[model samples]
Target: GQTPLAAGIAFAQKYNGTGEVTVCYLGDGAVNQGAFHESLNLAALWKLPVIYVIENNEYAMGTHQSRSSAGYPLVKRADGYDMAGITANGNDIDDVREKMWDAVQLARTESLPSLVEVKTYRYRGHSMSDPGNYRTKEEIAERKKESEPISLFKERLYKEKALTEKEYEEIEKEAVMEAEDAIAFAESSPEPEVATVFEDIFAPEDHCPGRPDRGVSSSDRKLAMAVLTMREALNQALSEEMERDERVILMGEEVAEYQGAYKVSSGLLQKFGAKRVLDTPISESGFSGLGVGAAMQGLRPVVEFMTWSFSMVAYDQIVNNAGAIRYMSGGQYSIPIVFRGSSGAGLQVGATHSHTPENWYANVPALTVITPAFPDDAKGLLKSAIRSNNPVCFIENEKLYGFKDEVPEGELLTTIGKARIRREGSQVTLIANSASTHVALASALQLEADGISAEVIDLRTIKPLDIPAILGSVAKTNRVVIVEENKPFAGWGAQVAFEIQNRSFDDLDAPIERVTGLDVPQPYARVLEQAVMPSAERVTEAAKKTLS
Candidate 1:
């Protein structure tokens, strides 16, 4: 996974004019991964200063390279990209150093990518558990005598009159003593306490506490309001953040010159220039990993996927790298990056293009998941997400891009874990977020026409849910209905329902009901798509059922 990050690390070096080169090492087996090719192509195309070293150790675990790889010389693969390729004998220390120095010079001076394959052999099994039964002992002894790195280096030193047999023996004795001292220290150290296991799982919360008023003050009433669409509001947030912080950068496929696939980044490239606003190739894994590396190197990056559905290709980078890096590195690094793009199923883009992944992303620990329903919330929450210390998944709805609302004229930053009470009632509580919040509001209107009064709560953030607000609503209404675009099985609503049951089960007048999308792939046909998604009518019915 880290192999895909070299391009991004090198990109930061180039962006900051650091004049540094990144050297990324990989096994021969790693070349088969899609991320490897995607990263290499991106590094080559961008002319990022990076050297990819492929250590072809003859065997990948138990299988020989001949059984797995297709090509004879792995170094030649770099020629396909019109990049420099070099090969060296890994067993010879001088040869390896001289070849690598050439690659390093090419990268630092030319700012170009190169592939250097070092042909080597492993003496021991892949791990200590396995015996060396794959090859004969004779073959192993022959390699040790003819091509062992340390032995060959010692012979070279002897021929050059740089060392004697006595000095070599003394160095070996010192090495053994150092290893023994390290083992002794480990054996004498006490075991870690059980409480330490929970430490460093996440960085301390850096953002301000959740403001119950949603950053709206009495003084803000005097401020002028502008009617803007969701797309415009989001664009304003990105522009403001980039201007405020020089470290902020925006990158994605078609985000620069093409002005975003949905026009969310219409004029940013011209304003920020190509250095701050970059357009990348259609390689999600490569660019996503690059964003993570840049964030690790102290740059604030906003990585836009063409759509959240396309982010599936970069799940390893998002989940394993971005989400887990803080814990894995023991809180030594902060991944302050935002992954934002349109999501949901209203468009006729078919099942492959439509995915409501809020539930899937929220399941991961150490990730902030936000789904804003209106233009104002979109602007405010996005600004906060850009400033957050944790990795954030900002899920937007394509259908709601053009929906207009009143956004404040000045700076507005909303808290990440707060919910807004859209409407007030006592008969039943209707909870929803993102596109479903509109459905819930419509359902509330319909319920009001009848005798039943319904309260609408728009959950602006999914993870770190505002449970206090929800419990207060549930206690007042004594009945609850959750509405969401996610499918019914193990959906986001299910988690909300569980929390309500666990915390306020005694206040319930009837069983809690959920209005969710049907458990099926979204269809391309307009009629079928509408049928598969959660509708206002379905939400109304669920609210009525909860009251009954």
Candidate 2:
């Protein structure tokens, strides 16, 4: 609830360009949540043009503020983050208006976040079902008499002669009539069609799937054969895209000053300036949500999660908000944001730091999931993801970042949800993506030595499944073995296996086999980690088994 509110503030601060100030109003209860502090800290740290207003009505759903909060004068909490803090008399409209205007102006001009606490008292119980049992009626009546906001505003307006008593009565009558009209309209409104609920899951007319035709001339070998590492390829793509679009921005922990945790964004900050290439604080949900908001407001944001392990912390913002916002808004908004980072295990980082969450991301409807295997794909697919009109989870492998290969030069873009035939053969099709594609490629060589002609397919994009490419490969081979680093249970390979079985069951010569990671947390030991991951040896064996 309040998390969305904070997310809205963070989004607006980063994305809103109309010079219109964004103010997020939250109840006293919201301040106790971790997201509240996380958002405030990020807002202050980033110096975002945001105003956070806390409605300190003193009760967090029947629990008194004194019981829940540790300190008095709630505005003082802003001091901890070195943010500007002020208290306003909520009962007086002049005080409220003046404080809000000051905070908004400060945020807009200085790009500084401020906290404005409006001290007020609730006139009624927390909800309709509850009675006035928590506090005395005398106390409630006394506070209402002393600090009623509407009464105070009316009194001031009357004293200033802004309206005559007759005009005030007419205004009150007009308000009542408008409220009655709204209620009448609601009651008379027709029920929505059942099909309407499913119409807005993604932007209409944006879900076509086909292999990319990046205009690479077959005769131009020089442009198509420039060797680069995955890091270099990604950097080049980011640079080209940022140069092409003024609204494209990069933000994440260590993305600016440190040039990305993996150095993939090393030269971007210097090239784009600190404003576009932002180095955000270690608040994944805050920044990710901020990116979502910015995307909604017409900016293309590339948010790097140092790893998907850290992105798990921002799952709510990513899945619930980013994935669903377009559908929830009935296709009125398209979230053109990319959440990318190094993913997978192999660096002895233990279970927490290493996880292939491609399956998790792919599970969400309307999300475009990409796991590029090599340098060319890393560059091309990332460029496509940046240009995509949907939220994309671009999964990059840290293990493959250093590996080098020739990538096409000049402007190149790959299609999302397309699979590439890496190595062609006749016997069995081995499907993989990201780091596991290397294993499949290696296994293909081994299979050749064993006299088994294995066709290897790199599933560049995971979400759309590229069923046509896979079916085409399956039709040729009649046998299949999928390789992936994700665990055996509910893994991406499992989905592929199911689809292959359903779509190409008659084409199959054997049951679909899968070479996947062991169903356990990635271990810390080098040998053990290797054991849990899919390997060339395992994939080779699985390919042979499919033939046997």
Candidate 3:
């Protein structure tokens, strides 16, 4: 779940048969989630006078409905639930409204969930880079010609003389003018003032939900195990934060139902209740949009995408809406939202799943990116992320979640824009983040076997990277290697290299080097996946290259 579409459904169902109605509009792709099935089953069993509107655009990315789903016209899936279902032409507003009217009538009369599928085609590609190799441009153009909903409605309105030529011209002019006005307004809006920086991370203690467990200090006996592993420290952090802030709601698919796919959110729902610990209908776009909306409204939403790769479906909300809101709204609103999950290679998750989002999101201007390698850093960075007033992408390594570390107790927060010195040495600086940080430290040990005193710096934050640490080390050591489990071109390491070169070109003894994942996508085979990302051997090799 991206935000709380299921919560919305629950809200709608709560009002069913009371002369109130709830309608949810979702893309055809959302049906692929297991949560959708659960929601459908719940709606069916409860007979929650709800209308499920699926905006079936025929394709989920390049994977068409036929390939991604076994069912045709997905509405018919309601047959299993014994609910009434109908398909409508989404391009026709009249058709949609008419079917909606009928669906509502049926739900009201029978107190049952009604499925309405609206067939439409997105005029644009999924997210701008789609080459349309999956579907021919001619086919897309034909779909556009036949199914351009807004224009289709306009045509219908004009042919019936519901609007004369002059009126139609007036309508077109008005729409264009309004769109132009919005664009101008957005552009002319002043940039956020410096004071606005600390505005929206969380509601003030008085306004926010739950009083801080002013009592639970690092000494809480139950949290002693936190000293054993960074994973336990993270669990303790979640417990303390949740106990401290009632309004800090956790939502995502399986976060509640399955105790989080990674066990980070285990037993959260039992403690927080469904209101705060929501389980979403695996509609990433819908739910993530809902979280964006909820954050804008007031709630401190911690949205967990199982994997950053899955975030591909909701990139628009993350980049366009969340990143642009404070500036777009003239600092009148701040989005106190956090999106976290695993990234990079952990196993044979393959090309589709094993991706590091460092370059993808770090390039965005407004986002705060945090990727911690060790457990202590993870707990501290995650706490900082949760407390910060800006949107954050808190990335964790799939391999390191269970790694152990001695985390200092107390209300500890490792500052956002600072780097950690993992090992102090004068030979060379090995800068790394997330899973690569450990590899850097291990290689530092391995390099010690040779006579190189390697210095390792854990760059906790990617966006506001601890440049001073990097430059200071580079000035002293005069050589550096940036490592990560991501592709080389336009990757995070590239940006780091660019920044260092521009700022400290005079300090380097030799050219900076970066050890990163292969240029190709990670393969499904274990050996291939291992080969795709940087290893300790590769880090050591790259370090030696700089030394040589």
Candidate 4:
């Protein structure tokens, strides 16, 4: 998981003009992972200053390297990427240092990545429980006698007359005493309180109460409103942030040169230059992990995927690395990164390309999930996400990118974790987000003609759900209808419905109804796509059912 992060760290070093080199270490087994290959490819393609050290200890757990690996010499793997490959005798500390020095120099001076295969052997079993059943005891003893690191180094020092035997003995005794003292200190320490289990899950900045100022001055509001598409609005936000902060960068497939897959990053590369606006290869795991690493280095990286469906390839980087780094690091690191891309159904891109993963990301604890419905919300929420100290998953809708609306002049930043009431009523509350918000508004109009007033609530942010706003609306309407474009089972709507029933069960006059995408893969056919996704008619029927 941390393998790809090295490439990202190296990228930040280059971007910041630090001329620093990052050295990453991985076991022999980790080289077989997809992320390893992706990271190396990206590092080589970008000529990042990094060195990947693969410690080939001859075995992955109980399995021998000969059986697990196909290649003759592990160092040859570097040839695939045209990277420098070298091998070192790990048993000799001097030899290992000499080989690594060359790799480090290549990275620092030439700005190139190198693969160093350190051939080593572990005499003991893989773990404490293992009984050395994989190999014979005689083989282990023979290897230890020939190349034990500590004994070999001591012998070398003795031959050079650098140390006496008495000195070596004293050093060993001191190390043993230090280890015992550390153990005694740990034994004397008190157990942590049960209440501390939830401590340090997120940075203090993430827990900051209330959203940033979303109010525009009365004089600025008098200026003419700009009618821009969602793509233009998002582009403006990215440009503004990059101009405000030099640490902010945007990278993705087609984000530069080609502008954007949806023209969202138009004119950014030309304006910010290639250093800040990067066009990455189609390796989501690599670039996403790189973004995580960059964020760890204090650079605010906004990584874009061609589509949300493609983000599944980089799920480990997003969910594991970016989502848990702050908590796992005991709050020492803050992953202030934003992952933004198009999502939801309506693109008719088939099952592989169409995916609404707001619920998937919202389930993560340290992630801020935002699904913007209108262009203004997309621009404002995206700006807020960029400034957030926590990782944010900004889900956009391809269907709404071209939809134009009035955006106030001057700085516009919407408050996250706050829902916007699109329409107010008393009959029932229609809760939705992203594209579904438009459907809910249309359904509200249809219900109005039938004498049923429906309140439309656009939940701009999925996580940190505005429960207070939801309860307030439910208290007035006494009925609820949740609308979303996700699949039926355990979808975003399901969580919203559960929250409403759990908190306002007695306030509801009728059972809560949900209108969600059908439980099936998105189809390529236009009619099937329409039938599979939530529509205005479906939302209207669900709202009517709640009223009934």
Candidate 5:
């Protein structure tokens, strides 16, 4: 299993030997992901000079650091990884720049990762929708007046004569204009071609197994043939890919020391050393965007989340930078990056950690979302994901971490967009993914017991769905139940349910039934949590209802 910090360490190790230093800026909240720990351990172990920039913005969404963390301060935590630490006022641009420059230089010279804590303040609420009532208004006012970064930067720029008042104002104006131009251009540009919805789902048709050097030595040995879990497979794939290409790296919280929240990067730290395996603070949006910027400079970074529920913190980066950059740049650049991790509800993880992000991201024409169900698929899919020229979301399942399945030692690689038939039958079609695919298969089993043959298909790649497979299945079965772990409203399941109803109106025996997570947010209580998501029994019933 891969922990969050291992994500950051991966990249640090990859870029360690190069002249450029890789920096991951994260917030106080992000330090909690399990991967964050293992990453630092690996970074220190290998001495792969990486800078861990912590933008300690005090609060982690609704919770304050005083409430969530017991700390002397974050930079000291870096010592646990045997790394050097620097703490400075985040609002002071001079201090921030000085500290960061020092950290970068130290990393380059030492080939070791260091943590730099910038005690900054976030002026806005976590996001546009945050009501922000947790902190007192007085506290907000005080922080705004005393520690505003931009304001402090302006004062320093003026006092130090870094630029004249008139020049500073002009620079601000240009920044505003540049931001506005990007928004305007995005709004006016044509979206990706619909037919190409099928494009980039896989490598250029030429990159598949037929090419001997598409990846690794064809003779890496088919060992035990099956002692690995999906997490192991994913870890191996990442390690192999990162080793094969100097440009490839990894970033996020716990990729190194903790091995991974699920232990996905168990042996990677030993294999690649520290500079490539880095740790980040708790800022999802910040580090994700940083990964995007690094990619722009020709580094391949794998940004892992302890789980995908945290991606809400970086929806903008995923959509704007990773997804839109190539197209927005008129195809002048490519995003050789992977934002990979677990997704969906499991182990009673409440509302905050249970989001199924497929539907939200599915709408973004510039990104690719991949959901794999088994070990072999996870490994093969992730390898392909890292190799991708575009930003790729390698979404995984916390619940499925231990799920085992046989994988080929050689050429059984699966591509994005392609759908797999988990099982086959004729009476009806059950289309689903992630957890739902498991439910659907169980439902199919129950259907068999009841004499209603059903076909089970896992739409492994959520975006660039295998629509043709879906259409053909529905055409033959005349009945459908789209299953998903998200709420029914606008979740990817609804998209399929509605699209199918419209496209195959006359070929139906019953309306499309959606077996999905309940509309309520996932609950924290074990019993209540189970009550929120779709289940084997519920799916089986839905399939039976369609037959009726």
Candidate 6:
């Protein structure tokens, strides 16, 4: 399940540890993949500290490079990317080392990525399964005789009087013995235990102080609260975190000079200066991967996508690299980065620009996904996300940015996995988050008029599900209705429905019903969009069905 393109991009993007250079070695065949082109484009554009070493052995598996790729030489392809390109004789150890060292120096000092194609040959077949049927035996024999790396180097050493025959033989024997010992150790190892199969998917939880059961303290309530828009609240949170920790930086399109597309980062550049609040090119893949690299180098980076829809460009880096880096590296690296932006259909923007991605990221185990309902949760949760030692996908709604609500003063950190019961009742449970939380609250008000007490739960965090709160509410109500703006197929509501049925099946009096967006591309027209999105009426109707 390894994507070399994504892995290489991730490595180059984040390999700035201790000002060291990252050299990514790949076969000539990888250049054909789209991710390879994308990665190179970003690296060259950003002047990233990376060296891409393409080992061109003349053939890609059974096909010759001439037949498979375009252009004269593979290194020449770097011209289109506006980066330095060079070639070296792979059989000449000194030549290869000099080229590689030059590439490393350029990347480290100039902040430029280089392409180095080593002219080489592989004597054997591509793999053990291959029968060496594609090339002539004479062609292979000629390569071994004239250009084999080891034999050519040994002869050169002897001609230079670098070592006597006996000394060379002793060195070869020691090398063989070391390799044999490594093989023996590997062969003696036992298979991993079956119980350990699920280990290391996510780092062990470093839980914050606040838990749902603890409830807000009386002294906590006495803290000052300000009525601020969701955008202002988020801005305040980012501002506070930046002030608290100088390592925290923000980067995205229009985040600096233009303030923000949604004005969520207004005044940040004025306060923190250009370096901390950077405005990047409109390349999501480039900037997002850069943030990953920056975070890997012991800095806290907050990367904002103009819209979650634009995040598709950087999906590979986000899901494959940021989500898996910690686990893949055996907890050696922590991608303490936040990828946040507006999500879900609300504006009349076409199908491509609208839609919620909470479920998409929530499906990832190593990521923490948060979709807060009100301004207070928005501020608190975003602060927590910034402080967290894990990759967090903070989903905000475009429709709710201007919506105003009260937020607590001073340092506030909402627990990542906790759900708050916005309104408590005992008849039926209404579950939702973000913009849809308001829908559930409205539905509860109508249900109360009809003499049905409905409890409303705002699932602040999507992953690390608050199963206890969900089960407790469903167990009391004995009936349930889930609401969400996302489509029904594999939606967050469906997962909530399954959780209720799995643990509170006996307590339920009726099957759970869900009110969600219609299974179709969101319409651009206002009337059609309204018809498709979940409304208070739809949720109330579903709640009544559960009651009936």
For TM-score, the strongest prediction is 1
Better of 2 and 6 by lDDT: 2
- What's the residue-level lDDT of 141 in candidate 1? 84
- The regions of model 1 sitting more than 4 angstroms off are 205-212, 215-223
Q: Give lDDT for model 5.
A: 0.75
lDDT of 2 by residue, 164-194 (tens): 7898899999999999999999999999999
Poorly placed runs, candidate 6 (over 4 Å): 1-19, 61-63, 125-127, 130-138, 204-221
Model 4 C-alpha lDDT per residue in residues 174-243, reported as the tens digit of each score:
9999999999999999998999878777665642323343321111335468988988899988998899
- Candidates in order: C-alpha RMSD to true structure: 1.9, 3.3, 8.7, 2.4, 9.4, 3.1
Q: How accurate locally, in lDDT, is each candidate?
A: 0.89, 0.85, 0.75, 0.88, 0.75, 0.84
C-alpha TM-scores of all predictions: 0.96, 0.90, 0.67, 0.96, 0.65, 0.91
Give one clash count per candidate, in the order shown: 0, 1, 6, 0, 61, 2
The residue-by-residue lDDT of candidate 1 on 70-127, one tens digit each, is 9879888897788999999999998999999999999999999999999988888889
Off by over 4 Å in 4: 206-224
lDDT of 6: 0.84
Error of 3 at 381 (Å): 1.6
Rank candidates by lDDT, best first: 1, 4, 2, 6, 3, 5
Task: Name the weakest run of 10 consecutive residues (lDDT summed) in model 1.
Answer: 215-224
What residue pairs are clashing in model 4?
none
Model 3 CA deviation exceeding 4 Å by range? 1-226
Q: Per-residue lDDT for 438-519 in model 5, tens only?
A: 8888888888998989888888888877777787788888988888888878788777877787788888889888888888
- Evaluate model 1: give its lDDT: 0.89
Q: Residue by residue across 250-307, what tens digits does model 6's lDDT show? A: 9889999999999999999999998688877776775777677667656788999999
Off by over 4 Å in 2: 1-17, 123-146, 151-170, 204-223
